[model samples]
Target: MSSITMVQAVNDALREEMRGDDDVVVLGEDVGINGGVFRCTADLIDEFGEERVIDTPLSESGIIGAAVGMALYGLKPVPEIQFSDFIWPAFDQITSEMAKMRYRSGGQFTCPMVVRTPYGGGIRGGHYHSQSPEAYFTHTPGLVVVIPSDPYDAKGLLKAAIRCEDPVIFLEPKRIYRAPKMDVPDDDDYVVEIGKAAVRREGTDFTITAYGAMVAVALEACEKAAEQGWSGEVVDLRTLLPLDEDAIIQSVTKTGRLVTLQEATKFCGFSSEISAIVAEKAIDVLEAPVKRVSGFDVPFPYTLEHVYMPHADRVLKAIEGVMTY
Candidate 1:
């Protein structure tokens, strides 16, 4: 086992997968010599060569469109959109082309491709750099969305996304890239299955459901709530789409309340889906209305970045609110 940052774990996964498969190719802007804006693809250019690890032009649409073609040709292309906010340009390709190819073609075609982008707030990145766009793709049918909170999940989930037989949107919470570390197995073939949620902490008063950067916030909230005599359960939802509803239902049923949290806009974010699912499946078990504490429904602010991101205080407040009700 070895302690590693989320970014380093991602690099290790790419290196390991490339070493195992000759058809795996990585392409994105500045990912070659610049090593990606977050350095998640660092040193890959040297190890995989320019042909496999490429630096493409700054066109999100073109990059993703070409990746679809590569997938059709049996080449596993991992395309990175510099930021999740920039993924709009490729929405048509992702939602229509990449997502529907296999289904629309009557199973004659498959786009086993991965679209990776860093997302979520913190690090003082303004609106353009900090949006969590997972909800957008999660609502679209035939697309898998994943958001891994820590280094171990980051590495393992990325490898699984690469090897899956369908298109996946991999959202990395850049905010916690280096803020946390964990002893992930050093095996080069580390892989975590998608569509699963990990129980971070177990308690009975209420459940704190979160993912990505907010997982840390939930953990902190649980710690604080513990002092106040509230035993809060924390569930790290590693994958947003193909959600582990069984785990969610079980947790909510056990606790009788849930505080769904995320760092994205509160209007139509991941929290909404979680809240709705609980309402439908665990309605009888809920002691209070599902609570959602998330970013305000406005563009992320330049000067108030910290205020815009969900914090431990906000999570705890919601937890207390649900528990009391």
Candidate 2:
């Protein structure tokens, strides 16, 4: 095992996968020579040369379109979209072409590609660089949405996405990209199964469900709540689409309460879906109404970025409220 940050773990996953598979290639603006904005693809161009580590034009649509073409040609293309906030331009290409290729072709063809992008706030990047738009992709039928909160999951889940037969939206939380280092396994085959929720903390009071950057915030809130004589369980929903409904129901039923957190807009977000699922499956087990701590409905702001985010204080308050309710 080697201690590394989430960024380094991602770099390792890409490097390891590319070394193992001849068909695996990475393409994005600045991903080749510049090694990506976060350096996740750093040194890859030096190792794999220009053909495998490609630098494309500054166009999200073109990047994804080319990746889809490569996927159809039996090449595993991992397309980087720079930032989640900039992924809208490629929405049609992603949700329409890449997502529907297999189903529209009626099982004869498969689009095996991974769309990687840095998402969420905390770098002080205004609206254009920071946004949690996982919901839009998760609503699509053929896409798998994944968000890793730590270095281990970042490496393992990425390797799994690369080997998957379907397209995957791997959203890296830019906020915790570097910090919270861990001793990640150096094995190239390490893979955290997709669609499973990891329980970060165990408690009987209430359950806190979150993913990506919010998982750390959920753990922080659990720590604060612990000091107040309340215990909260933290469940990291690593995969958003094929959600681990069993884990969520089990946690909420054990705790008899639920408090969800998300860095995206509060209204009609992924947290809403989680709350609904809990209500449907574990209604009798819940002691209090589900609570959601999330970002404001307004656009992501520059000056008020911290205010617009859901911090540990916000999550702790929600946890305490649900425990007492």
The prediction achieving the highest lDDT against the true structure is 2
Give the true-structure RMSD of model 1: 0.9
| Per-residue lDDT over 1-325 for candidate 1, one digit per residue giving the tens place of the 0 to 100 score | 8899999989888999899899999999999999999999999999899999999998999999999999999999999999999999999999989999999999998999999999988877787988888888988878889989999999999999999998999999998888678888878666999999999999999999999988989999999999999999999989878889999999999999999988888887878888888878889998898999999999988789988888999888888898788
Tens-digit lDDT track for model 2 on 216-279?
Answer: 8999899999999898899999999889999999998899999999999989899999999988
RMSD (CA, Å), candidate 2 to true, equals 0.7
Error of 2 at 53 (Å): 0.3
Q: For each candidate, what is the lDDT?
A: 0.91, 0.93
- Over 4 Å off, model 2: none
Worst 10 residues of 1 by lDDT: 181-190
TM-score of each: 0.98, 0.99
Steric overlap count per candidate: 0, 0
lDDT, candidate 2, at 121: 93
As a whole number from 0 to 100, the lDDT of residue 198 in candidate 2 is 98
Each prediction's Cα RMSD? 0.9, 0.7
| Candidate 1 local Cα displacement, residue 110, angstroms | 0.7
